[model samples]
Target: MGDTANNTENAPKKSFFKGVKSEFNKIIWPDKQTLAKQSAAVVAISVALGVVIAIVDIGVVYGIEQILKIG
Candidate 1:
């Protein structure tokens, strides 16, 4: 009974890896130029978003400080 339970647990893991391998094999990887462009776009967008968030955060902090001073 114990052996059967262990085998059942391992069976799912084995099948999962097999399925993952099959899916990976089907993927069409991007070429070097396309990959480089995509990576650069991602980096640029991330930096822009970070700057916007930082500006918003600073504005909020300054507003809070002004309110505290008024109080």
Candidate 2:
């Protein structure tokens, strides 16, 4: 019957949501102090990498300009 088919279709969805909720409950979230330290580390590393890339770019451009002057 159509009612049985509809029940079977919705059964998978209900079980999937239950599994998702169970998994969410098992997660151990980081505390605020740990979160702040991790965030600061990420920002500091990003800034340092940006500076390095800029320095390398400037060097490459300068080298190319010097080569053009020679040619």
Candidate 3:
């Protein structure tokens, strides 16, 4: 009975490792040029978004200061 329980617990772990190996075999990895282009695109968009948001935030703060007579 104890041996049966031990094997039952080990069965899932064994299957999990086998499944992991099979999945790694099936992956289609991106090549170097595609990877670089995608990375640069992500960075450019992120920087443009950050600059726009910062400008909007500064404009809001300046407007609020004018309303409160702080400037």
Ranking by TM-score: 2, 3, 1
Clashes of each: 0, 0, 0
Residue-wise C-alpha lDDT for candidate 3, range 1-71, written one tens digit per residue: 79999887777577789999999999999999999999999999999999999999999999998999964
Q: What is the per-residue lDDT of model 2 for residues 1-71, given as tens digits with 9 covering 90 to 100?
A: 88999888777677789999999999999999999999999999999999999999999999999999999
Encode model 1's per-residue lDDT on 1-28: one tens digit a residue. Answer: 7999988777757778999999999999
Between candidates 1 and 3, which one is better according to TM-score? 3
Question: Which ten-residue region of model 2 has the weakest summed lDDT?
Answer: 6-15
Best TM-score goes to which candidate? Answer: 2
Error of 1 at 37 (Å): 0.6
- TM match of model 1 to true structure: 0.72
Model 2 score (lDDT)? 0.96
Off by over 4 Å in 1: 1-19
User: How do the candidates rank by lDDT, highest first?
Assistant: 2, 1, 3
- Report lDDT per candidate: 0.95, 0.96, 0.93
